[model samples]
Target chain A: MAIATDARPQRTTTVPRRKRVRRTKGQKAFAVFNYAMFAIFALICAYPFYYLIINSVSANNLSALGDVRFWPIGFHLSNYGQVFQLQGLTLATAVSVARTVLGTAGTVLVSAFLGFMFTQERMWGRAFWYRFTVITMYFSAGLIPVFLIIKGLGLTNNFWVYVIPYLVQPFNIILVKTFVESMPRSLQEAAEIDGANILQVFFRVYLPNMTPILATVAIFSAVAQWNMFQDTLIYITDQSLYTLQYLLYMFINQANSLATAAQNAAGGSLSSIASAATSQTSTSIQMTVAVVVVLPIIFIYPLFQRFFVKGIMLGAVKG
Target chain B: MTTQAVLQEAASSNLVREQENTLKRGSRKRVGGKPNGKKSIGMFLCILPFLVLIFVFSYLPLYGWIFSLYDYQPALGLQGSAFVGFQWFEMLVSSPTQMAQILQVLANTLAMSFLGIATSILPLIFAVFLNEVKAPWFRNIVQTLTTLPNFISWVLVYMIAFSLFSSSGLVNSVLTDSGIITTPVKFLDSGDHVWITMLLWSLWKGLGWGAIIYLAAITGIDPALYESARIDGAGRFQLMRFITIPQLMPTYVVLLMLSVANLLNNGMDQYYVFQNAFNMQHIQVLDLYVYNVGLTGNNLSLATAIGMLKSLISVILLLTVNLIAKRARGTSII
Candidate 1:
């Protein structure tokens, strides 16, 4: 439906174009100025990541001294090694990865299913169910109540707890519904004429047409799950079940141990090295942990970026 | 016409009408079928997973609020817990020490959230400006850059703030080296600066992602509107002010309502990352207060009570705003 509205204006504009209007000299200069401003803004945004990545790889003293190095002063994997050396890094990383994958898959599946059901022409009480889901989207049961509920269920430290609670996201359901609602009713009419049942029409016919929106929802859910830190922080009491973000939290809070550890870990006096190793005063280790936690998001960003662009247009074009 | 032929035509027409009626009735019945017997079983099966989640995590725990009336202890394990109805609330609300702390935390949270919104509004405007440019590639690149920060976790954000603004960090180093100031400012640890820095950190994280929706709405405005305005001698500023802003109002209203509804949600994780004892007074929010009392302080009942109060108030506020929007402007958020 949203796409139809968006296409409506473009459809009218595609007639043979009028001759280009002559631009004033000021307009040409202003366009150049706009281009320059945009380029500078882009550079400022990208520079921080460049700086962070370069600094994360630097050797001990360089990391602590906060040198303005655009390139790595002394590159080594030891910082990453130090990050993984944190008590529960491996388990936490694994748990977070598993939860995110399953959680995204589960949320997309349920939301898509509900969306399809809501769009069914013959589905009874469709409006009631639609309004119920919308209310849930807008009115949460509150965080404390949610936490209390999690505790009462004995899922405080349980593995299934993480994915189960967020298996269905209401906002995603609404977005998918909007997409399905806008689909041509003629398609469903054709399927009915061919003796297709409602379930068959939905699964075999409509779902295939829903690929783009499904991809959009999948990406949104996955990104949200990947960045989920708050729930795990509150509910997961056991340190072993910590997610990547929580592990990073531990490192950030323990910043005093971070500075000298980086310096000595790179190379230092025996006493300093002993103090760094035993005292664990290395910032490099925390930097390493930060790097590990952030790497996946950085790499896969461009792929998801496309879907986000498409998704943003879907909502507004309708209204 | 033969009498037999006329009779045959009438019979066939009647048969066609009967089939149409049956099909219509069948669809209506299926759509409105009651959930009972075999159909009830199917409905239950269809909704089993959602039910399990809602029961285990939402409904059951609502019953668990009974503990808030007790001095809950792990040794007592809820059953053996001592009942202390309104005692914790009294201690919190009546006592000067706890009451003052709570008020301060509330004040801090409000200031942080308000300041964060004020600071981010400019970036949103900038995003609108960027959207007006006809260069697609440039717009995409700029947008990607701004949104990249949003994806970085709060932990990384904290690290960046410390590295840039710490006493020994870049900002202070430049200040001292350039003789702009004789001493390095304590950007992270100073009590007065914490709220401001906290808001800045949030703005930095959310600037790009926040603006994306507004920009999308802006782009949705018909290009013909701009053409009309241009023909009418409307300059860019006038066009934006009169046409674009008005068109974007509904989207803005919805976004504003969401932001206001989420006012109490100060994002405990970001503040938690940035907090130190030195600036604790300035940085504490209601959510943080609950975390301290409930999780770290191990005063489970008190924490739950506080959380319950906050949630109730926030929900009330949300509903009130939503109702006002619906009644006054005909824009219902739900």
Candidate 2:
């Protein structure tokens, strides 16, 4: 199982390669048209997000009329302030931070251990373990079955509800196994010769070498857990235990909450709160939520951005 | 450095092994006869957390699949629930409404997924071209901007769409200003456009992220291949066709395999986020349907039965594709 591919970066094979031949007049026109078309399409695909930021801070007129565009007419941080007051943005932020840390740590530990154990050459019943994990990968017991199981196990309404069910992601296991199996056998042999047992070799020699892959996996797992909304919706009936995404979900779905937001912002005008509540329900709020939720990942991504390309190429090429 | 030294080394190894046997017995006695006991204990301790979580969440919930056989009530727990042995599944098949909905959902899911795959091809082609552009700054900027959509949530994507396509949104304003149509098109409500919208948006969000793997594959390809092709008077198109595409084929095959395997996964988050009652009929994929039935409708048992059926079909489809690849192309996913 410990097939080490790490040392051998596949040597490049030479092939009959393509050349960038000069375009004929007609072909050049076609190329220009293609570039124009794709550029327009990319801009169209990206404009809404640009529009979102512009709309979020524009005057109420622009947002209510959906007229927000390339720039804001005037800056008004009212919406952001409203969201903060309505939800106590800091509380939700704290909850998200806590959940991300706890959940990512839990997932990395479980998936890494399972991956390590699964890749062990001398471990008995290797086929059974592989089949077992892979079966779940292909054939899940469905969401309801999972829900019922959680309920059956009395995991519902607990913070562990978020942390437990997804503790061992099968794909991450595969990724970790790919990395683990690629470790050089000489490390293990050297450790064994030094009187280190299997556990000692895995922990002391193997685990330390896996830091880069583990960090990358942790980033993926953390983003997933931090953005987990639907699970909290299902497993957590109590408001107190809801994750950040669920809170955003509530803001988006619940009109009263929006009204409450307006009321809380205005400090006593029930009618203005009521009037602005439904009318001000622009797409901007949704974008605001998207911006906030994704901001952490965007900021964090650059640190490990290089690893993603490496990880995917490795996983795909090896497979 | 000599043969006698090697012989002496071998002799010492044998002598050390003999002494080690006595030490092993003494150590076993020291640790109550459990040879390798410390290692095993450490191994168990290392694996303990994972075992507890998986058992409670994965293996333990497996028993709840029994609800597919029972007219289950959550309040009653497993014991008090009525066991009806495939009755739920039988009902799923026998009822035309249920069966038709499931089939339609499957078809819609497949169509949307196919549309997504189709949309991705153009992006792949575009990315390759983008790579060929001489300006490094422009290429890097485009690449960075393209992945922006990947970071955004489904909910936000839908909002962006809603503003663009809604009755009073920008598109309607343009159509009215141009005097092309008398009234707003009700784009979100238009059944004809719902599937297209879903496919388009999914592609938009996924295009850059999707192209990333292909780009890596293309880049990792040996440039010498292209150089030789140039020497042979091959045109750009010919080079891409023969060299680049062939080089990228393995990545493409694996990507296609994954796309095929998860064909039914028409992203509930995106669909649900974008859905309105008006468009639900057109956009309701199997995942959304299951969510509505099981959780929203509170027919927990029925949802499980439906989920079970879908999972079975998906597994079958995945295996079939894998087997076909194995037999014909020798590039199985497994």
Candidate 3:
């Protein structure tokens, strides 16, 4: 019988022995505490969305809403119906969808292409160009100047306002650069050996292998475009071009105004009070709109969850 | 320099030489003395669009900051406007009301940023505890749910606040129905405790997302250390204290330093959405104030001046932080 001599450290041998040992009383208590804490945290994280869904379907009566906690009371869909019927809803939704699809695709392609170019060692003035891009990460010429530039470009009210300004994101480019650097150089070397041009190598070899990171950046860009209201708040003055987020923001303002008006009329004429009470339903409609806005992200997030986590880790570790 | 520093420098220089050698070999294989000019031009063309974009969007903004030195009237344009060197900056310090507002905004910005930095360690602790969970499925579920809020926009978050914390919202309704309070609390409207409220909301939105890097770092920790610790009769808590915490320290410190460097860059979105007349005094941070003063008040020069000051200060902060990091860790981020 040959005695097997393992070259591994004592730690490796001890790992299995340690796992076989029974947990102590302290360990048991700690596990219980850990479970309880995580459960509470998870509940806190998830309850708001659950509550919104519950309350959106809850009865429209203020008193009925007051009783809603864990479940919908006197279930109703009228609030969503009212939200769907709101002015500019269709136009805003169309703009939002278009921006998310186009903006994400455009940003992903541009950033990845630039990223691949930056990784080529023999490229002229590569260091200077790299520094030029990276330094923008820290310094910016403030909001007003950027706004002026956009105005000068006549993109203030243009739909491309959503697409053009965001075409080259420095942070995403850096992420893609690091990712491309991490890929086996032999893959590109082999392609070059086979007489593939730079674009062909990028599209055929690099991009196919970059699906995870590309998807991650695409999701990030999509979520950003969908949620962006500031561009509309600053650049776009036309109501027809308003994104969904801006529309929701306006609705929130309208709801607040209606609520204040109702409170002011509480001690006044009966007819005025009645009309104010009717407008108070705007609060419920606001909740319904919130649900609508958040639903897409909530549904799509799970699909890309693994890729995002990996992408973030890759970026952080290298960054 | 210490021996360790000298050794690291030599090692890095050796690595650079090796990389250069490989590049030379690659270039020799491609062409003779010079690089393949055609390929180099092709690469340049590939990156030209990005270069142009960076110039148009980013560098152009710095040039546009020249408007600060002039009274930039939109109708008159920068060319026709009168050049007023440091006029807005002078006015920022000279005018009593404007100076007071600047001071107030500065206070709000620093206060919120400091609170954020103070609580930055919460994510580290959160990740550590989260990693202690044994059930993979449960851990995944908790993480998925917690990270969901990070994807949601500030606008939607404010809407959630309205639905849950407004006067007739769920929380107040519950509190009143249970006879816990005679009056509904104005959580969203009241300016009192605004900093703490904002901090809480920030924590709610970012805790899980922020913990992700730490969690990843935790995964990278060698299990052999834990095994050895266990064999050494170290309990779970002791193992965590002695091994896990120490391993995560460098990552936490670097992130903390970065946060300190970015102390002035609290973006305006969250505050902008949450702002009301009641809370505006406490909520209007530097960036939001820039927008309000510039666009709403139509004081373009003043806003540009303020924005330029902010950028200069931020760059200074970044350099100073980089220096500190270099001194403390023998490495610098930038």
Candidate 4:
């Protein structure tokens, strides 16, 4: 829907060119200025990632001295290799990937199912249950109380803490429901008329048609699950359960001790891989971990950006 | 949030009408015969697990609110602890020190939220100008880059901040080497302009993403409005001033109200990651205060009380905003 509308304006713009108003110098200048400003702003937004990436790959002392500005100096993957060498780094990365996959899968599946189910009037107490679930969006149980509930449920140190509690996300359901409603109902009816039950109709007809909205939900869930650090901060005390993002959080905040401990864990052998002038320092390690944490989002968001624009438009209109 | 979209959808009678239309169309065509009891039950069974999960995570957690009524010793457990029945609430106002601390935190939260609300127009302006850009490719690249930061975690944001502003960081080195200052400026660590700094960081992250909704609103405006205005010889600026801003005003107003309703919920993650001893006094907002008091300070009951109040007050504000929106715009925000 959003892409179609976006395309309309582009189509409209071309028609104005055939008219008698030849391109004026003032308009040309304004366009140039606007394009330049946007380019500068884009650079500002992107430079930090470039800066971090360059510094992470740069010689350690040069990076720490801040001499690697604008570009990498004595570039190498030693920091990245050493970042993985930090004790618990592998475990945290595994935990982060596992939770992101499981959490996003659970959220998308349930949201899609609930979204489809809500449209089925045959479900018992459909409206009541729909509102009951959606109303949770309006309020929260508060941080401490929710923490206690997680504790009481014995999920405080459990990996499922990352997945289960977030599975029934209300907004994704609404997005799917709205998207499904917007779709033509003929296919769904055909399936139903072919003697398919609600479950079969949902999976075969509605689910396939709902792909765009589901992709949007998947991106939201994945980014959230990947970036979430607070739940780990509060709920999980187990070392093995530390998420990669949380581990990065600790490394950044704790500054000296935890990172050097990681360095020590990397120990003399990994340090021996580099000369003294370019050995991986704490700052380089922090940057490397940050790059690691952000790379997935940087790659994933752009691919689904168009789909989410549609999702956001659906949400904005509904709002 | 993903949930905010759902919350908006919840109040939409559009879904109900659409479902009704589909149902009536179906029955009229005999596409689906009246679903048997078995089929209906099977449909219900499919969603039954989700209903249970919602109850457990959403409703069951409310039972933990009872801890606010007690001293809430984790070691002794809730049953063993003495019921304090609003004592924590009383202490929130009764003790001078606690009152001062709570006031400071509340002040920080409101200050940041107001700053946020104040700059809410940035996105609208951005979208307006962005729409003027005839180059679609440039627009997408700019949008993609600017929106990138919003998707990253705040901890990663802190990493960016640290890399740019730490004593040995790039910004400081650039400035000091150029003899702009004798000493490197303490950009991240300083307590001064903390609210403004936090607001700027948030804007840097959210401005482009926020503009997306307005951009959608902009697109929804009838192209005929622009065509007619162009035929009238209205300049680009004039068309924008007359048509674009006016069309976007309602969306801007509604979002502003929603932001106002969320005044107490300056989420803690950014504050948490940025906090240091130097900035602790100024940076502690309500949500951060709740986290610190509960987990770090180990005063779970007090934190629970504060959290409960924040939730209650936020819900009240939302309803109030909805009422005001209904009166002003003839539509409820909820």
Candidate 5:
């Protein structure tokens, strides 16, 4: 239904030519200025990542970094090697990957299932249950209580803390419910006519047809799980349970403290201070860790970009 | 009638037929509802686990808010602890130091959130301009690259900031080596213009992602309006100014009002990572302050009391915004 309205807008292509014909020299200059501004804005948006990648593989010394402007200076892979060799990097990466996959999959399944259930006409107490979950979207018990509850449940220092608390995200449930409601009712009725049970109709009929919205919500859940660090900070005290983001956070803090220490020791002998700073984690290693954390999302983003845009559009239009 | 109007009429009629069919089917189901007891049980069973999870995770925490009334201790537990009868609430208002801290935290939260709302229009402008980009591949690349940062963790963003803004980092080193300044400028922890700095960081992370919704809104606008405006001698800028901006106004206003309602909900991730000894005084927003007071300081009752107040204010804000939206637009998000 939304696509029909959206498609109506693109049918009137005669406007472009008419608008172009009316453009004067000053208007043309304005167009050029618009392009220039966007170009600069795009550069500003993209340069940090570019700088990160360049510095990550660049030689890990102050002298090598001094003249570096747009690209690597004396490029080497030593920083990445150092990043990989950092204690707990592999374990943290594993934990991150596992949580993202499991948490996203579990959340998508449960949210979609509940969403499907809520849209049923004959479901018992549908209004009450729907409102019960949806109201949590506006008001929550606040942080301390939620933390105490999670602690009370003994999820602290547990991996399930990442997955279980987020398994039934009410916002995603609403998104899925909206998507399912927009689907033609005949799809479900036809499956019912074919002797499919509710579960079969849901799994075989609705789930397949829900790929676009499901993919969108999956990307959302995946991003949330991957980027989460606050839960680890609040719930997990053990170093072994730290996700990659938290590990990188710790590394950044460690590096900052090292720098601060070096600054404070600046009044000491130059030779001792220089050696102490050199022994600390280099700027290149920190950037390399950042590149490591960010690269997966960059690699996977394009694959899901189309559905992602559609999902956002669907949400905005519905709202 | 115009073709578009005819199509819309046909769509609405079809929807009416669908609704009628569903109503008839619903009546049939109501007549046979008692006989479908087994099936209803199965369906209820399917949703039972989710209901349990919600009750446990979401509703249970609301009950846990009673911890604020008691001097909560882990060993004694809420049951064992003495009920102080609004002592924490009393302390929040009566204690001068606590009142000062609350005021500061509230200021930081409102400042950051208002700054965020003020800059929200940038995304609309960005979407308008980005829609005008003629090259598909270039626009796509820029959009993809820009939105990619929104998915990145704040921890990584802080790392990026460290690389650029640290004392021995690239920006400072380059400036010093070129004789721009003798002493390195502390960008990260200087606590100067922290509001603007955080706002800029937020814009960098979210501007493109935020623009996606406006761009979507733009796509929904009927092109025939543009066609008519252009044939009447509207230039590109004129078309955008008169047609596009006005079309996008409702969405902009709704979003702006919603952000105002969410003034206290600045998540602690970015500020948490960026915060240190030097900048904590300035950067600790309400959410982070709650976390610090509760977990870091081990003052659970005080944290819970402050958190309860924040939540109450947020609920009020949400209801007020929803009421305004309903009065103005005849729709509430709820």
Candidate 6:
């Protein structure tokens, strides 16, 4: 009589017993082969990072000779100390971090706003405006014209060049639009019926549902902003506006000039032994700088990984 | 008889419209006066800034194509520059050597793009095999590691390449120490197999990231298909061969179409970073060539002319692909 009151008995009573299926030898063999292949491939993908990390930590002489592979030989933090003292690196890192944060926030908000607006059929001339926006996705004005525009706009050597010129990206808009369209109509309607205006409905009802797509768009923007050097290469000659990637690029290009750069950065008072140590090969400087450039990406990558696959799926499903 | 019937229909519809208008006006008053009109105008105002921005950025640049029709002088400015006909276009093909150089660049662009298309199938195969792995955690780890390369800049990739494959780098050191070869290989410095080297480098950077769409598509495949195959004594490989590749074909085809539309655009970043005096002859794609001609060579007009042709051809190709897609798939990407 008390059986009806039991809470945990529903599944056992209604459902069939599950059966275990034994795997064939062929399946087992394939599984082993697959796992082995995955191990090797993963190792291949991760090895360059490992190599750079090991060499950056190891002593200059052995690493510069390429003898520090497979393991770190002489562990030291001197390279980090030396790298930080390079002029403009601190400023560049700050600039890069600022651009990444500001640029991502600006782009995500713009994309979300436009995406939500494009979905509103009641908006005046929505179709024409939507097409006008989306058509920019197909083509681009070539390098010279783009450069001329930026120069005309006085973005050259300006910090805002990193932010302003890319504010209205069509591809991001399309992704956001597609994601917003996939959301249930009832949610927006419910909010609107409860006396919410358009912006209120957007911020309250839609923005909360927009986290995954926004995360994806944020990743796209952040990575593009963080990894951006071409703009810096062309627009900004001012050392104060140099980005971390651009500074790293300068290091890689003039690896042999590191001693001069370090000495000059230190105001030419570097002692003999330190100067001698700083005369390490281009490989050491290159690897160490490469580590600095890649460290931010590596640090934030795991946090973004969970959302990327889901985000990518949402984008692809729009197709 | 036809006129009378049409007039009757119109009269009835006009009456219905009048009632609906009254209902709408009542609701408008309830909502504090002309809500839809005000709301629509508000929305338009919100997007107006974006429209102006896109116009200035995207459409405004078309005006620069006129520079190719002018004798560009840096100090004179675009306005003060002398107007010329299509002299640059004529000069582009006027000489045999100039024509030959352009041809070679085009050839390199086509070769690289073809190689890219050929390797586009690798991601599909990768995704197929990757899906067969049952452990979600293991699959995720492999995916995260593999996708790491795509997130980094091409400069970083080149740095990694230098560290791993430079003359005194690890590979050569290992090879020479083992006495497999007496000398270190000129992997990065040599001009040999430049296309293949570039392709491999791109694959290293893009393979796992490229597999993402196919993997997503694979997850969307029906589970019943696999269950039925299992019941029918079909093995895993058979099921994959029959279902997986075919199911992924639409996505693959769409990507391929987009790539084809972008045939001339072999992106310059990887090639630019990897360029050396040794590989410069083979590595100079159209974009890089245009850049060199404009800034380094100081032939901005000629560069603009070439870039103009490239943009025109690309837009035409995209339209062609859109038409084909519409015909075949009943939907166009554009």
Among residues 3 or more apart in sequence or in different chains, the pairs in candidate 5 whose N, CA or C atoms overlap within 3 Å are: none
lDDT per residue (tens digit) for residues B1-334 in model 5: 1111111222222333334545766666543234364436677778999999999988899887888899988889878988998999999889999889988998999999888877878888988887777666667777887787787888988987887788877788889988999999999878788888888888888888777777777877878788777668776778889988889887777677667777898878889999988888789999999999999999898899889988899899989987987798876644
Tens-place lDDT digits, model 4, residues B175-238: 8888898788888888898998898888888887877877777878878787777768787788
The CAPRI quality class of candidate 3 comes to: acceptable
DockQ of each: 0.30, 0.27, 0.36, 0.53, 0.40, 0.33
Cα deviation of B271, candidate 5, in Å: 1.1
| Global lDDT scores for all candidate models | 0.66, 0.65, 0.78, 0.81, 0.76, 0.77
DockQ of candidate 1 (2 decimals): 0.30
iRMSD of all candidate structures: 12.1, 11.7, 8.6, 3.4, 6.5, 12.4
Runs in model 3 deviating more than 4 A are A1-16, A19-22, A62-65, A189-195, A256-280, B1-39
What is the alpha-carbon lDDT for the whole of candidate 4? 0.81
Q: Which 10-residue window in model 2 chain B sums to the lowest lDDT?
A: B1-10
When summed lDDT is taken over every stretch of 10 residues in candidate 4 chain B, the lowest stretch is B1-10
lDDT of 4 at B29: 42
Which candidate's TM-score is highest?
4
- In DockQ, how does model 5 score against the reference complex? 0.40
Question: After TM-score superposition, what is the CA distance of residue B183 in candidate 2 from its true location, in Å?
Answer: 4.9
TM-scores for every candidate against the unseen true structure: 0.82, 0.82, 0.88, 0.93, 0.89, 0.88
The residue-by-residue lDDT of candidate 3 on A127-181, one tens digit each, is 6787788667667899999999999899999999999989988767767876777
Q: How well does candidate 6 score on lDDT at residue B41?
A: 79
The residue-by-residue lDDT of candidate 5 on A192-267, one tens digit each, is 7789988998899999888877888899789889999999999999989999999888877786564454344343
lDDT of 1 by residue, A39-91 (tens): 77667667667766776777656666566447887665555655554557788
Fnat per candidate: 0.26, 0.27, 0.53, 0.56, 0.53, 0.42
